[model samples]
Target: MNPLLRLLVLALVLPAAACSTLSAQQRDRAIAIAAAARAPAVDCGQPDRCAEPSPLRALAGEAFAASAAAPDGAPHHYALLLDEGGDALLARVNLIRSATRRIDLQTYIFDTDDSARLVLDELLAAARRGVRVRLLIDQLSAIADLQILAALSGAHQNLELRIYNPTFNLAKPNYLHYAASVVCCFRRFNQRMHNKLLVVDEAVGIAGGRNYQDDYYDWDAQFKFRDRDVLVAGPEVRTMERNFAAYWDDRRSVPVERLNDVARRLLADGVPAMPPARPAHPRRVEALSQAASDPETVRTQLVARAMPVAAVEYLADLPDKHHGDSALEDGVGAAGLAGLLAGAQEEVLLQTPYLVLSDHALEIFRGLRGREAPPQVRVSTNSLAATDNPIVYALTYKYKRRHVRELGFDLFEYKPFPADPPVDPALGGWWPGQAPADAPDPEVARSELPGGSLGGSRGSAGEAQVAAKLRTETRPSLLRTSAPANRPLPVTGAGPRMGLHAKSMVIDRRIAVVGTHNFDPRSETYNTEAAVVIDDPAFARALAASIEGDIAPGNSWVVAPRAKPPVLSGLNYSVGKVLERSPILDLWPWRYATNYEFQPGPECPRPLPRRDPEFHRCYAPVGDFPEVSLGPKSILTRMLTAFGAGLVPIL
Candidate 1:
């Protein structure tokens, strides 16, 4: 039997033995606790409440109504949100403040961070103004604070919060209980609502990869995600509203009042109501409020001045997609994405944080490559040094070479910190060709070598020699930057470490897709995903420009045909590569390894000072390597990964 399989078998059997040790009294107490945690269902009546008119409609609805009319005959209006963090936040807040009738929000993760609080405060404020608010969040990530959510919902009659596919046990949820719950309810626990969208007044919406968190918006001091989102106003907003209603009306979506009667009672017993924190960025709030005052100006500035309307299609998986239902019922699935890719005539650009290609995706790639006139295919994903999830990186690393060779796809791995100077806004920030001359070309092999030769398969003596040769090569050329010698360094210090979290695709410079779906098994089979596919050349080019900035040499590493050789300068890289090939050991503290890979070493250059404290760092360039580490918390994380690896197919 496989060692990993044997270990998993032992785990399943041993857990039962441990449970057998519990006395009858202890078992009863546990059952009582779980019973108390499970809340009774509350019926909110029909979904028609969401369509009611609001007082603000008279003030702010005219612009959206006009935009949706498309006097010029365009299908939709879109503005690419490239503000890193603040811009996206402001956009959502502004929409909420401007909304007159209803606001619908659906997200996978609604963190307790400042970003979430800011948005939540705005929602409460909107509700106070008599605008209806409906929020749908996945229960898996939101169950820990049921009392708080219940209190919030109870406080506002106009605002309703629903937890999608909630667990029966919600009180004081710990890791062990979570694991037990998963074991008992494996089917429901494995599936998540991995969708992020916000629609205002059923007239305009914002949808894309960003979640409600500081890191997504560039506010996290330690880490920042290079992400993307789109501001949409037009007929597509109505489609988004319909998607929200489907999830909101699903039987599995339990209202917070219904989730735990005990928690609801506790709230009635006078638990202190916790109001949202004061806005961290007060100026941002002021700006949004000012923009809300003039809906026409906001629309003109966001859409007319910058983005233009074009053909748009909203695509989303059904709330019941986890039930193994047919793709026809879901409306969105891997098949939709595959069909989109198949239609590419000249070029396909993809940006995803994770890239664990499925068999179906691989077959599509193979089909594309087999074509007599194959389009140029390029992919940008998180590098080992930049990925937040190391287990996913390990799996993706195993197939890196195959993706490049078999599919002829250009792959670029993002760098944690690039040393190039801040990009000129006029030239488009982080433009291509900002890295050293020696950076690998995705289309060219280092040598004319066949498969299984040097730089090919693992375990070959020739491959080892090739790795050694690569390690010995001079590093100066690879570290050179595009900045002039006389240019002064940033004064504020290095900015937050950057990672790729955006899920976007631009095909043939005429079609674009932006959403929360990562190109991995989890997204393909386990989680429900959402995105907007725009079929306009102008809109596609705008999105493509933002994606190209992320793939630029200064911001990302081009995956070479040869594996990046282990070097003393990148000790974490050596360890990560070794772990990637190991069976039991690879799971060792994957998160620690991921962190270690991106941690600065002795050779790392000092962060230049910048005048603005929020200014992002422009690092001195460096060579590529596998980023990894063994840290103090690795043991538990590694053990978790070991167990979780068994569920990778479903994950």
Candidate 2:
């Protein structure tokens, strides 16, 4: 290591000596303080458990009972795709409410916002009613608010919470502590528990990309995630239980009382008595609560949507995903998706928010493309304007050529917001069963937003006119920004924006995969993740349809090769390829491909392939980054495209 770097590391690690780990005396005192706030046990008649009698719980019971007689390895499981955000949240709510014996939820981030608080309230209620509730959150992003972690320290005797892989054994690390942690224990700090799951009563569960935050469930007014999740019952739930237990019992999964920040809060303030939470949107909460409890509504929205499958295999990475001894295949989530794709006989439909691909992932695609009869590869990912992580989007931008020219990928970058922006600001309620009712028709309601045509995805001439309107509203100049990866170019609209966060795939339209694995290097090598792989053509088709909807011209932008410059097109291609192939920098101004809008007309009723002779005639080039300004983000993207390959493994 460099001498200055070594000295800096030493300086960072030294101050952590006084970190708030509990000594013997302090430990006892902390225990005493927390004991006072311990949840009162509710003794229900049945074996210290209060299992609910509801249609949701019954679905699991019936699934397990029916699965008992299935083949040893191929057991029956029912799966439901939660493409809509409201239904996704409603699923979690009903599953928790219906949980009889135990509820285990594992997530990457558990924010203290309304969405999280409402779910937290539910888990607390479940604990109070005598249902064992255990929540395990990744330490880095888990409960950043120290007070909430402190209160949760003694929230309930039945409700247990653990922070996974805490740096300096602290629940909420300060900026100083975080810097030192990255310097002193880089591997541990980088490898997080990216798993998102909710297993109830060891009978049913939800596994997918949603973290406990408003954005994931379309509740955030500023932004939302078009995320996906799979609700599974029967044999798959057993796998979820075991996977969660592995993380729960792992050494790195530290208890609340063991954390330094949480411990200090417990010692200084005693265990905090949690006040009754008042939801940010009471009507929204009430709507979901009523729908979750209503058997008819739950049945119609969830149970009816479920399709029985021959096999629903649950795959998850080991708790120590980045351990030195772990093999690449130890990432169960990655391996499952790989195996499914390897057998894609017809087409492969993949959707993920972060589109950066690891070398291993690129190699997989390469292998598929090398086949004599390669299947169609369709990818739906966030565009520059729609993405939450501008950094990751830059990486995706860096490799657009390889994805389109080499891999033959039908790349569809999701629009900022779609016609049906998951929450449906149209109806009275937002839940899949209950929706927002205060809106006029979608056309009128959408037009009221800053960039009303933003979600139209229609690729119409009117869209260009709206873009002109948006340009007038936005600041002409880019804001002065200095951050390398955090800088964001201004998107056209300022109103509520939506991004795609769903990580999913449909293979041969025969299998459906909905999981938290983004297939990036982090998911492939660093963080642990989990997913459900269901083998049912019906389910696969249903999943494909949902993804297809997201990629519709009105919902997304087609990424394709820009028509070769009329003159010296050949020379431009050669030079561009050389710059692209350069190991260090990809500075060629002209890119191989750009976003295209499908111009609908009497002559062109449907989409056309880029190879079609009349492709450019029907599809208009929309520049490299549409609805996005020329700014620091674009400059950084070019810089990273040249120098960011090394950052891929860690990022």
lDDT of 2: 0.74
Q: Give me the candidate number with maximum TM-score.
A: 2
lDDT of 1: 0.58
TM-score of 2: 0.89
lDDT of 2 by residue, 1-651 (tens): 577996787686656646556687887677677767886877565663564456666767677777776666457777788766667777788888777779999999888766788899989888888898999998878877777777887987888899898888887776677767777677777888889999998988898998888777766645667888988888778888998998999888988887767777888988876766777676666666766777786776667778877778888887756567656553354466777777787799999988888777888898899999998899999998777667778778877888998999999998774544445332111221111222223223434432233122222222211222232111111111244355334666544466788999999888889998877889877888787888888988999988998888877899998787634778767877777656577777777789998999998999887778998889998877887765665787677777776677866
Candidate 1: 10-residue stretch with minimal lDDT: 469-478
Over the stretch 1-651, how does candidate 1's per-residue lDDT look in tens digits? 566865665576546434423445543443344344432332234343232332233323444555568678555454455434544665676667766668999987777666677788778777766678898988766634544664564556577778887655342344554555555556677778888899987777788887776667654444556778876766677888998899999887876655443243443453336544666554434544454455553444343334555577788887767665634532354338778887788899999887877666778778889899999898988875566655565456555545665677777787655433122111111211222222222223313222121122112112111111111111111111233211111111133445678899999999989887775777877788888888878888877877776666545665543222334425544555566445455542211111011223464443222222321223322333332233343343344334444445663
lDDT of each: 0.58, 0.74
Query: What TM-score do all the candidates reach, one by one?
Result: 0.68, 0.89
What is the Cα-based lDDT of residue 377 in candidate 1? 90
- The TM-score, computed over Cα atoms with residue i paired to residue i, of candidate 1 is 0.68
What's the distance in Å from true for residue 155, model 2?
1.5
